[model samples]
Target: MYPLLEVHLDIIGENASKVLRLCEGKGIDVVGVTKGCSAFPEVAFVLLEAGIKILGDSRLDNIKKLRRAGVACPLMLLRIPMLSEIRELVELADMALVSEISVVKAINEEARRLGKFFKVILMIDMGDLREGIWPINLLSYLDSIRSLNYVELLGIGANFGCFGGVLPTPESVSMLINYASLAREYTLSDIPIVSVGGTVALQLLEEEK
Candidate 1:
């Protein structure tokens, strides 16, 4: 009885367990970015039941569906925030992966209106010529956030599969990791989330031993 599309819960369970164990006592949390199969809430439901604390997707529809399905887990949006969709995004997303200062400010304004503090991960471009700020431009964004008080700067993240395929290189990830460490050293972020999420790198990250 295989459905036309399905997510393998066993692999997900194992992957989740691995991340949890690998980051044990390392002050890291794993959120399944279910946008890969979020059109089907059942996929997210399975991951949720397995104890994934956060569920992330890029679609508003999927976010609403998961919420409507009674998912109690925190929801994070991975798409670029649209000013027009600010209210609904804020209503549905507990957190957002953001790359621009304007969007960050917009979320802050929306959150303030709603009397809420939204969590966010500031995305570093890291050679991903996509949505994030260039390295030279990132410092200003960081400095800008420090002056703002409505949104919580959760950490940092990078996407590796979009816009010129600029995010998938080791050099790119290494640069980001190094920068995050430097920022942490300067007390900007003590524990940055240098996320490497995508199927392309999965094989490399898999247990080859």
Candidate 2:
């Protein structure tokens, strides 16, 4: 016999579905962040069943746990990856939010060695001062990474309401969108995912800006 915390699985599932519906109605896809729940497999499954196409977790171990539990959604590392974990990150996550070019280069090298294609969302620090390339240097950074074969430039993203408590406003998000446009112009390709950070932005989704 073992001790376990009691949980209302049905309610959990209902809440997951409700949130996903709300976000989807507003033209946003939910990542179903699982780190807060310690990446519990059952809870993760509830989110998956509720139509979460992407799973976001801060820790590599949690990502590995999701895969071990047979969750099929593409996993995203919400934090900038460490060089030491590049091999596992490449093997596990479908995409990662990144800031430093050096780390991306390492990911590319590891992916090449493993014969795998890795995806990255270049994070920009839009006054939040967290993990992102400075806006001024972004285009130059894009140029440097364009020739990388095994690494796919997924899109650009930013973190707000994080360390700096910077609220993600219409203006801030617009700035991120503008950066995405610049990225597209530089690469001459459609930037696939311009991820707007945090649950706070959900409140503003209805506005047609």
- Index of the highest-lDDT prediction: 2
- The whole-model lDDT of each prediction reads 0.73, 0.87
Alpha-carbon runs more than 4 Å astray in model 1 = 1-28, 166-170, 185-191, 207-209
lDDT of 2 at 187: 91
Question: Model 2: how far is 8 from its true place, Å?
Answer: 2.8
Highest TM-score scorer: 2
TM-score of 1: 0.82
Q: What is the per-residue lDDT of model 1 for residues 158-202, given as tens digits with 9 covering 90 to 100?
A: 777677675355666677777677656654556547765555445
State the weakest 10-residue window (summed lDDT) of model 1.
200-209
How many steric overlaps are in each model, in order? Answer: 0, 0
Error of 1 at 4 (Å): 5.1
- Local accuracy of candidate 2 as per-residue lDDT tens digits, 111-189: 9999999989999998778778889999888987787988899889998888888878888888889999989988998
